[model samples]
Target: MKKVLIPKRKLPWGSDHEAIIWLMAVLLVVGMVNVFSSTFITAENENSAPYAYLLKHLISMGIGFVLFAMSWRVDYHKWRDWLGPVALSIAALLLFVLAAGTVVNGAKRWIYLGAFSFQPAEFAKICSVMIAAYILSYRVEHKLPINILNAQYAFIAFLFVAVEMEPDMGTACVILGIPIVMLWMAGLKTYKLQRLALVGLAAVVGMCIYQPYRLERIKVMFNPWSDAQGMGYQTVQSVTAIGSGGFWGMGLGQGLAKYAYLPEAHTDFAFAVFCQENGFVLVALVLLLYGAFAYYAVRIARDAYDVYGQLLAGGIMLLVVGQAVVNISMVAGCFPVVGVPLPFISYGGTSLMMTMFSVGVLINIGRYSRAKQAKEKLDELRRNNLKNHEAALAAMPGRRRLQRIK
Candidate 1:
């Protein structure tokens, strides 16, 4: 008798996963090119090699990719077990930064180790998301109440206050916003969310008033031209760069903004340099890539295998895309200059590595979800085939006699 053959089931690739990888790759390339273009003049003026910033950026990218791979290989569910230690470590680091971090432009937000610096607040953002995911998922599974006085809220507040003391209100705002958004998505009561919103608003308002510089930023945001050469200088320059790009741009490496015309052109205002050099057409393309990223990120979260995965992906999506929105708006004069860097495009080692790590976790969740769905599909196919075979046997002559003989 001839042997019957069955086909092996193959795991399916998720479109969302593929799209995310491509989008990230494109953004990274854009970031590399822009960083080099925007910093060579400044590097030369500072008595450094023209490619100094570019080389450092390349090193950071290399390290970031390695971290991305490691994160992608780890099981996201295991993060629940590691949350406690990670949160404690982050808390310690934040305290250390406040005590002895490197000061730049009046903010103590970095810890210098030799030639490299680390930002605890970036990791703080990651910890905030993980804490919310673990606690919210546990509450949901145990059928417990979603109280506002849980460890989730405590950790978020701790991170917020620590980062705020770094005087990085931009990062502190982001840390606070991440968990509140996650809470709402996890089905917290509307009244509770509203209350949280009001408190957050009050905190932000008080913080602004406490710092005279922050209030000055708000005033300059509304009328950058009023103080064109003072507090509003950066904003005015950024808007001018963006507006001068017009439809076709000034061409690569040909922009005047980097000639001592715009401060921090390669860091916080990198997007402004990009807009000035690449024109409105490429700007639109960059925006579209960000839009596509958000779309696919939402799809991944929606199709996640469990609640924790859903919330994890959702929080990360909000972090990356929300930060991008705020950075772009700040550059375009739609929002105050808050020192928020554009993800993947800004030239900061700590920010780049942490962003890539978070994205890797998201991709791993997508991969697991895709595999689960494919396995379910394959099992259903096998069951249906078995049912059809049994029905055929029942309809055949002497089916009972054949079954008894077997």
Candidate 2:
């Protein structure tokens, strides 16, 4: 049998956290630049300044960076205890949004705060992960039997209902998807898992039947050409934008489809805009970056110091990276057009900030794991030295005899 060789590359700043940051950095830079190129046209016509959208994105990025720094250094353990209150707070916000949220594109998802707006569901993703990690790890740690339908899952169900009511079907999927993945990773029993899957399937069917818009998306996905001007408009335009990019792209800020031709040039279909401006060459590079992020995120989760940390990091990775996969798939027409946003690349205030904070939490767990490994090595060495000293003392003279005599 041959052993596998996994190379360890040191991160900058001499940290043994085994953290990966460069890919995220690339995504942010590319996201900001592409977002600017994709929206400068609309911004120019909507406002006098062509850079207005870019300036707003920069402000959002600045806020996200601040959150990232704080979460990256904080201990991951604290979130375990604070999961309940945090989740409740998010649920309250969700309800408030339903009650008095600012509607956009016929959906009441964003809650306005004076001049700016933010999405509570964005933060709810993290809260959902935290609750799962906390409950699962707590059960294992305390030797409690797994109750599949405990208050923990009930809260998540409530959140799902709230988000779905917001008519943000895409975000609703993510809300439940995070928990299902976490629960599976946390080792749910096969029978219980099957039962949950059935329930989830039933829910999906109900949602699709209830929302004619969702059904329309499915129809458009299979053949956008049928209604290219109706429900298929966004999908047809999205694919068209990607196809127009060709091999080398039209160059930055040179894309014409974004000029009132394709909807959401900087949001759900931002990847399409990215391709339209940078072509397949940068697309390949961007995909590689996204892959690297997923790989390192899983590695960080695997290297966590404890069960709680492992579940925590794993859940965060699922939420962040999983959302990216969903969004990209929707844009490529591989999946139904759901409004899930790319993690760091999507032009938004809350999603980017929440994603950066997730990465920060992952990095913090990695740092803790490194320190734990060092401590374990030191303890092993001390034990070995003690054992050797005892052996030598015993062989030196009548150590056993002395003990017997005493």
Candidate 3:
């Protein structure tokens, strides 16, 4: 008998994974450069070292990279079992933030831990996706109906209210938007979805009216120049910086807007500063990177190994890309300023860490999907080879004659 050897298969590393990794690296590098360029003047004005904010951003990036590595190495399925404790811990933190969180810029959204401040709402957003993905995937797996009255909705609602109470409407809206998008993707009935949409709309309107400033922001979104020095000040400055970049930009770190002219130049409006310093060409390139990210993320989601992975990847996609869209629109004066930070470009430690963690999980899912596909291919190949070997044996000598005689 002759020995048969099956070809060794390498773990598949598709373009989707490569694209995501490259996109993240490029965006992080751009973010680091823009963070320094945008914040140096502000740091000097505060009597701090010109590199102060850049150093802090670097520290956050280091922590985020650690998280990303851990998430990529761990099995994403473990998160399904840990959801209960994770949700409880996040809920408690949200409550604690409401009670005694550090106040910054009139928003009590952070809790100080040693030298670092933590934002519970950021965790809540990712947790909400996990919760929704787990619940919906479980129900579908068990052949159970996905009712609106499930614990997933309850927990998400609680998170939304807590974040809103923190007076951080931008994050609250993001928290709310995550599950709704997931629910739709989960194949909820159209009627239920419509009802949910109506309720969401009503709640948004009520929340806006509850805060007079929110209404003002909405009005200013439509006509920012109506009162340029009042509610529209940030919008006007953001637009000016973006437009001033012209075709080639004013050159990095040379933009005049970041010299205390535009508030939150390093945080919420980091894109504006980047546009001002890098010009339309670089802005277009950056936006193309984001667009490519979204495209590859969608590919990963659609090709996930199972229903759970699909939903999980889809939720993460919405979380990152959706937030980027909202932030860019707000900065462009096309939407109300909701203070949402651009994903990798924003200078928030917790946000950058959580986002990196989510991307890590996504990458893990992609790896699993590829592995499963490779295993399937190997199994099919083995089966086909075995069939061929059996046919050859039967065709040789008296194998078929022996069977006929029997």
Candidate 4:
């Protein structure tokens, strides 16, 4: 006799997950507006069309949407197999960038193609999370803290250091930190984890001291007025732009700071332009949306039926929230301007694509959670129905022993 082949099962996205995707879409729309606002004055100075930069960003956004849709359709679990190869490919690209990448403002962080550029560090981040999740899923006892020097963890650290050599500090930090958090959440050893963290900190400190620009950025952050016209100009202008908006804002497309005074107004400092035009109210709303997203991501982890799914959800959550903190901190002058872009709001093709891919993974995790819950609900219903049936049988005369069957 021939046996029948059964199809593999997959999960469906939950309501909250779908809501977050919509929120991301809304934020992208708002981001486009700010990108356009930041470009107008600069384009005028260069004799370019009024919307040249905005048009380019809009085009990128269109591409991002297509990638986002594709990601949503594919199964994230397949990445477990693809993670290693894709990561190796990305690692090679980063190495290539370090050796021959284009330099923009002293950092060789992009692989350029005539009119387009791609940041490998961006994609490397998501890949790191997926790889970390795959490695940590083997832990049998889910505890707290984790050893950082294990072969898998060390690989993650090495990958991050390679990205950092591209000298993308913000991406490097996130790439390294997110995996550590995921591993810790999956269970390891706390005292051992602390030791590795201290060593990592010392290494980072040494690297910072060796790099003049990185050191200079740190100094300027501590004292923005120290070099008001040089290293400090960006932060100072950012503060002014955010401050001028007050509580309500100067109104959309009416911001004075975008008149060429605030550098990177549409990219790294896009939040400032957003705050300038939309005020604290809208900024708070953006924060709320992010908070909601973070909340749902955690929920996905908590509800995941298996260890891999849990770690994957947690790692993705950490990546998004961690990046948000770094971006906002730079704009707020709490940290040095490390060139991290606001997710869904920054104007870059590679950044947008990677972010959407992470969202796709999170959506996949949500699907698993939904499937697990549905299965549990079905099992519970079956148990209840079985009990009811037995109880009804027990009610029949001479059926007193039916309760034992349950």
Model 1 poorest ten-residue lDDT run: 6-15
**Per-residue lDDT of model 2, residues 218-303, tens digit only:** 87899998999998998889999999999999899898788999988898889999888899999999988787777877887887
Tell me the spans in candidate 4 whose CA falls farther than 4 Å from its real position: 1-14, 141-145, 390-406
lDDT ranking from best candidate downward: 1, 3, 2, 4
* Clashing residue pairs for model 1: none
Q: What is the TM-score of each candidate against the true structure?
A: 0.93, 0.92, 0.94, 0.88
List model 3 lDDT by residue over 106-161, tens digit each.
98999998987889899998999998898888888888876668867888989999
lDDT of 3: 0.90
After superposition, the stretches of candidate 1 with alpha carbons farther than 4 Å from their true spots are 1-14, 394-400, 403-406
lDDT of 2 at 328: 85
- Give me the displacement of residue 207 in model 3, in angstroms: 0.3
TM match of model 1 to true structure: 0.93
Weakest 10 consecutive residues of candidate 4 by summed lDDT: 140-149
Roughly what TM-score does model 4 have, to 2 decimal places? 0.88
RMSD (CA, angstroms), candidate 4? 7.5
Error of 4 at 92 (Å): 1.2
Per-residue C-alpha lDDT of model 1 across residues 79-154, encoded as one tens digit per residue: 8888889889999999999888899888899999998788999998888988888888788878887766986788
- Model 2 poorest 10 in a row by lDDT: 10-19
- Candidate 3 at 179: error in angstroms? 0.9
At residue 182, what lDDT does model 3 achieve?
A: 88
